[model samples]
Target: MSNDRFSMCLASDLFRVKKLKSVFVALILMFLILFLTFAVCWVGSNLVSKVEVSETPSIEGETAPTITQEEKDGLLAALDSVINDSLMGSGAICLMEFLVMIITCIFVGKDFSNGTMRILVSRGANRVHLFISKWLTMAILVVAYSLFALLVSGILYAFKNDGSFTGYDFGILMRCFSLQLLCNLASMTISLMIAFLCRSSGSALGVSIGLYIILSVALSIISTVVSLSGGNQDWMMFMPMQQMNVAASAGSYSTDQLCAVIIMPIVYIAIAFAVGVSTFVKRDIK
Candidate 1:
């Protein structure tokens, strides 16, 4: 494609998404859900956490009230844990995925619903370019949402801890969040494929949500059974959501585990886009 056409396709896709009221609604709704999850975690921590009192006696018979080095390390570790949970936990990632599903489903499925895609193709708009533009647009939105979530989590952490960021590894947080973003992209692609196949926003949304529920339950049962049988659940690592959820706490991840985390989602994205785009190019738009 020429550079001018390429730019136009991208610009058109972005503007379309930007004009969708549901996109902003989905973003706000997803963020609220994510924030509530963290808020619950914070409240539960307060309920269960114990206050550590130093044992050293002062001249006036008061406890020193100073935290020991070990306690400080523990606090820092706890902070890191919260950050990870916020970024890459199953709840957070799933919420992000659902948001992607809604946004992409509407964005792509609407074109079919309104006969816009058919009109575009009739006017010589390349089907391949349209696919690429929509894919890239969804990717941009997913990554932006992930980054915003990370920022909000960081802000809440600082507010809760008096603005202290000590010993919190921003590097590791980014890496794990990057993994979640990859999963988000793959999930978006899956939803997009369904949108293309179904070609109706409502059908695509319903199918995607139903599949999500079924897969979540099935994976949980399988993982539990494997663990109780003393069998390794390493196979679960190849699944995008599982990989995204555990990545944040995988302190001793093997190189192969890391590779799966990165590679599996890319594989999903490639396969999904291949199917979605090919069908889109050949299938009759209704």
Candidate 2:
């Protein structure tokens, strides 16, 4: 196919799928998650402020207590710390991304199960092109969702917490977004691959969810064992979810854990994409 024709074909397929109710439902869910994150941040920041106020020292003589600059700084730091810890820490977004992965699998698998894939392929829509286009579209959507979630959370945090935003802590927010995006992409690719492998939406969802639960359990066991050992739980850093937790911990993780945070997601994404492409290429459309 010529470049122009390929582009036209891709555009047509994208529009068709984009108009589907499932796509809109997915977007709505993404926004709902974003709103929930904002709500979590807002409540967490307020709680931190309350705790800070309760802990503030009263002046010895003056009826009106004056807080020092250092105290103010401490309060702000406490709020930021608590809010970040509650919303972004412990791989919370990673779990959310796993849910999104299941949604992506349903969408992809339904296309195949409902005979859309065969119809599209019969219309000279190259399988590789269709797969790549759909993957890219989903990745773009996931990235957008992550960004919206981050932005809304940040804005809500600032609004409810003295209208102050910390420049230094913005990096943590960005990292959370990046981690969620990468994790979503990795899981989406894996789900697509599974859908192709199983050829049944129900089977694909079951297998993907089952593997996710198994991996979570195995990783938790490994992390627990590593922590119980005499060491600093360095071995647990290799797990993807653990790495994401390290990324979200703000200052709790070591340099090695930080590096793992940067590496594991990339490895997962690469492997998922490779497997997805390979399986799609070999699978029988009919």
Candidate 3:
């Protein structure tokens, strides 16, 4: 069993599977939801603007508050939060990560549940090579989807902003995307580890989602405690998703913060990948 030959065969076969095809469709649908949500909000705001002219009746006793320049600027800033490219890109990446988790559960968990993994091992395939190939295939999918989501997000933002999306810097968008991708790759690693280890699709799905929720709540609590203790927020840069969100919102990061963001995700992905591969290699399959 040549490692390269077996890995390629497995990757190719996995790509052609109906389950994988459905994953792609799910990704597309998720993207569409993001795009349509922005479009609908834009249209709804415009309709509300038109309706306010005649329907907003003036009361004889009450005077409306005067709109100040500072207030107007604040409102524009808030609007920018919703219609900005960086925020949209971050949102799309997050949504795709959730979709990928589901796909990963189906991809690896089903193989174990159906005894396909054991059959492949019995046929003389190298376990290490199999793990590496599977990781590479999922990585490719993530990179491709992340890039597409970023582009779609930028286009949608451009349409919202009077068709001038290019006014925003591409470098900023790329930086945000890079941070988001790192976090997503880490998420993929965790998902793959759980799926491969569980050996049951339903259990993998439940565990993965449960773990995410627990982590989120735990991190939030940590952040709150740190804030109340008057500790410097520099330490918060270690939180992967928080770092990614900061990158998206700020449109840039300092050199030290960027290094931390990049290093943390890599450390996580490496640990999970190593553990999953080591365990799978030693396990007996009937």
- Model 2 stretches astray by more than 4 angstroms: 20-82, 86-92, 243-247
User: After TM-score superposition, what is the CA distance of residue 281 in candidate 3 from its true location, in Å?
Assistant: 0.5
Rank order (by lDDT, best first) = 1, 3, 2
In terms of lDDT, the poorest run of 10 residues in model 2 is 86-95
Write the candidate numbers in order of decreasing TM-score. Answer: 3, 1, 2
Best by TM-score: 3
Query: Lowest summed lDDT over 10 consecutive residues: which window, candidate 3?
Result: 48-57
Cα lDDT, all candidates: 0.76, 0.66, 0.72
What TM-score goes with each of the models? Answer: 0.82, 0.76, 0.85
Please give, for residues 1-286, the per-residue lDDT of candidate 2 as tens digits.
5566567656765676567676566666655654565566556646545543325566689665556556766766775655565456332355456656666677677778888878878887777787777677667656765666566567755765578878855776777667556656766777767777777778988998888778889887876786787556775656655543443563565677667766776787788777777887887786
Extract clashing residue pairs from model 3: none
Each prediction's Cα RMSD? 5.8, 5.6, 3.6
lDDT of 1 by residue, 1-286 (tens): 5666767878978998899998788778767766776676666556334445355522465454555456655765675467446645455555777778888888888988998888878877888888888899999998877877778766665655668755555655567677778877888899889988889899999998898888888889988899999998777888755754654555557788878877888998999999999998898777
Q: In model 1, how large is the Cα lDDT of residue 221?
A: 92
